[model samples]
Target chain A: MSEQPTHHGDRPGSPPDGRPDGRPDSRAGGSSAEQPAVTASPSRPATSYRTLRLGAGPEWSSGQLALGAVSTGGAALFLVALYFAAGGFDLIWWLLVLVPVLTLSMAGSGMSLGFWALMLYGWFLLTDSGSFTWWSLPAAAGLLVSHAATALSASMPPAGQLASAAVHRWGRLIGIAFSAAAVVCCAAAAIHGRSLGLGPAAYVIGLVGLAAGVWLVRTNPPSQPH
Target chain B: MVSQRRRTTTERSLGDWHPTAAHARAVILASVCGVAAVLGRRPDLLVIAAPLAVAAGWGHLARPRAAVTGRAALGDATLREGGVTTLVVHADPPVRQADGVVTLASTAWVERKPASGIARLDDDGVAVLGLRSLRWGRHRVGTLSLTLTSAWGAFRVGPTDLPDLDICALPLPSAFDTSAPTPHPRGIVGQNRSSHPGSGTEFNTIRRFHPGDRLRRIHWPVSLRTGDLHVTSTFSDEDAHVFLLVDAYSDLGPREGIDGRPTSLDVTVRAAGAISEHFLRANDRLSLRTVGAADVAPIGVGSGNHHLRRVLDTLASIAPATERRDEGEHAIRGVDPMALCLVLSPLIEPTMVALAHTLASRGLTVIVVDTFPEHLVANPANVHESLAWRIRLLSRAAQVHSLTSRGVPVVPWRGPGSLDHVLRDIARRASAPRMSRR
Candidate 1:
């Protein structure tokens, strides 16, 4: 039993003679004179027992580091594909790449949404309109990979190892999500260089099409991979 | 066989699931990109936004609405020093798609497995964390907090805290044995030899057989040689009372647990336990009284395994330096007069030395077992502390010398055979005749 920090009469602030107060020391006398009149109290309160904060913060497990790498790598791949597709680089592009890498630990936050929006805005502004590029397919894949990896990384603690079952399940879900992107990319390519020429109704039709896409995406049930 | 003991708590509600930051991020990005793609007439943008839309939709659709509840349990509530146990945390109605992480806080004298104290729940929502108790005493195991994240990290349940569990760690007694007899053997049913002759295993002498002597004790060879009836006489077996007076005024040295160097209190408690176990096993009645620690209740004279457990429990309950004003009057008030008194202390406090002198003055056989840990002064943190220890030790030596001058033996604790020589000498002195003035 180590000397736990004690309260009451035995505290360090007690008199030098080992007495609680400035009372006279009677221990030098016979045993009969040594007894002191003091009120008995409980040794310590129940709430005093508390956990100790030891060591530094927990280190990231290998699984967590791997997920983080994948997230950063996917975001970088997307930026590189976008740069090549646009055939130019800007100062904002460098900032966009740095944001994802720097905020990789906060992948679960709204910062992820903000970064994705900026990346999409860059692609829209830089790429030629009314033209389909093969780079779009790989760039879409990169963006989806980044999103999936960030979500997975945020699901567990830094020290928590990713279970093989969970890894497999997430992999399958990413595949399904990317397959949707592939389908959309193929449809967009098929309609390249063609115009239906529906006139003023195209705006109303596009609005209806956007609403339908939201509904279709929102109503789709998640799969159980286990 | 040692049966396993477990304590399980009732399930507690963790409230309803809420959307995680990931879910909000996905839904917002997907919605904004979809509208932008349609308005800007960029089909390529729509293709890039497709995956985000799918992820947001799938996560929303798969979000579990049922409220979650969690419970934690311990594999064993009591353990010996250096014993290992398991803590299991469970989330009711296991969510297969959700990722669960259980974190156990770091506590004193407890070594957690995986070093991080974090364990992941399997498909059944069960997480097991290993706990190894390093010292003996009543200890509260670390608090366990559980967190659950829904599929695709869309939603989360909680980082809900569970109730803390308690473990009673019993001290591991050091090896101790004594072949010498106690000073006063006054009761029946023990292995000690009494002065009066009677039927026993220890032979006394051959004597003329009395009418009540059993035939089995008759010495036939002696009877034939003398042509008279003779019997083999033996000393009667009797039990003695052993009283243990423990000093808990201060616990010196670092608390390194059972695996490391012991503090003064650690040495005292374990030595008391070893002594109790030894005497109790020999069928001698034993009593335990603690001076400084108020929490420890005095254990009365008893024998057998049950009494040993009671003794150890009392020793385990010692909280050092709790009662600074203790005069040891209550501890020694009604002690058995003939009981062999063994005072276990570090002799750092004047109160214990006074108590020892008082007990010896009452004509009781008192032996002070010095429990001062040598490692305390071995490598002091500074020269001042080292000098302080040197001065204290000199004073302590004077106290020991005073006790010895009064015919009370002060012995330093060394695991086995520590008290054998002193006990043998005490027994011899007890048997010797003494002259007194008429």
Candidate 2:
């Protein structure tokens, strides 16, 4: 069963201390105790802003700071891999290191798609050897962390202080998502190293695997109410 | 006279859900890019698309199963100007990850704290907005709109508009009072002391004790000195009838709210409230009639606290310039012959002036209260408008002179003590003998 809605405690007309003497104020139509019946909104922490506070200062809590560090650090590590993958000659590859900072601040509304695609292209260009590399595994981990962080940051309001429980929950989800990418990376590396020359049969198996992955992604799960 | 139904608690059914651009972007980018990466023999592209694939999969898996509905209610329906009331908006089957916004559209004379009129829902899917009415009268509080974004801002339900809520804002009465009594006392119960002697507190004289005199009323000192029983006599308490005819034809001046100067209609309605409050508290019978607004509900003659509320409610229902079909006849119909008729008007309307003359012709004590705002003459913003008003007011001056010549007093509303001098004069005139025209 859903929890009963809590009273909005900070109503301006409500008494600051408590119900006023249990006697109705003729002007207010009822006592302070009866005010709860009138103003029954969900309870919120006193610090929560009433409106969406855009462009507000970053009042980072410990949980938010930790989450921010993990997300940006993962993105920065992925950029280092991309630097080596791009042969480390061009100065342009170094600019990719700042994707983490952009993800930290300018995350919302799928705006981080550009950064994600750029990192993927950096990995794609490293395929000049015409063979899969084991380094793709760590690169996958870094990209997954950055994506999860962007999603988390977008979900939160600008001035919102993160609750520890929410951060932990998102962290668990991110871990699970990265684990799936890691599993796929391991399978690809095994297939590439084995040099399986099964020809048309191998192509058939790969196609089947791709189909299954797409089906799993497309399939809807039975939704449960909160 | 504007008639409107009272608002009650209601809930809106869930609105149609639509896929947001954010959701589509994640799905399209993930699926198309993932398939192309495998075709191109690139595992790196697969990694990039994996998280987005998870996002798309999660959104579809966790979409809201049931329809999302919203309910809104006001804590109090009636409020004095500047008094605050709470509005609560709630969504059913709360989506833990969803972000909901509650918006109250901007309305004239209603001040919202945030000014933008938008508020964020708490985790439990409820939002609270405070509304303060700046002016008096029956006003529709702004329309409430609710929008909910669920599943990582992927799926959405409504920016659906809920039903309009209304509030009755009673005018804060202008400070007014009078020690002088009403012109004509007719009813048996009231605070006014009449000429005839009966049961009352104020002493008229001492007389020899009659057979009907109670022992409590006997004056022992007078009896002992005169060698006969004597009793104190007092004037009987009576009540007066006050008939208020409000003119709602024109609302002059800029429609500034309570913080600024009042308009002509504002002055009239507030003056009527102050007069009604003062007389009602004194236990006087009051009746209200509106000439220019026909939609306003009719109020009959009554006394006591409950009747006082009815009077204020009727006053709050006034909508200016609504009763063009109303002639002065319906307003004066069934009015008590002995009642002192108070015609509240700006004197710009000829119908109001004619109504006052008609009341006087019917042998009723009539008084015209000029409710034009002082700022109209003092602060004319433009030269053309000032010139126009000056000419119009000159014509209005002749109308006032006509009413004065017809034995009807024309007095401007000045809040406190505005009617004290006129009411005392009417009472004095009522005491003198006069011939009635046949």
**Candidate 1's residue-wise lDDT over B246-358, tens digit each?**
99999998899866889999999878877887888889999989998876788888998778777776676778999998999999988899999999999999999999999
Output per-candidate TM-scores for chain A, rounded to 2 decimals.
0.65, 0.59
Give residue B137's error in model 1 in angstroms. Answer: 2.1
lDDT per residue (tens digit) for residues B133-207 in model 2? 778787787888787766544566777789988877776566667788887786889888888899987789999
lDDT score for candidate 1 against the true structure: 0.76
What is candidate 2's lDDT per residue for A111-131, written digit by digit as tens?
466666666666666554345
- Model 1, A1-226: lDDT tens digits are 1222212221211111212332222221211221111111122212111122224534566677688778778888888889888997786666666666567557666778788877888888899876677788788888888888887877776656677888998898889998998999889888877886757687788678767766654522322111
Question: Model 2 Cα RMSD, Å?
Answer: 7.7
Model 2 Cα shift for residue B11 (angstroms): 2.0
RMSD of each: 11.7, 7.7
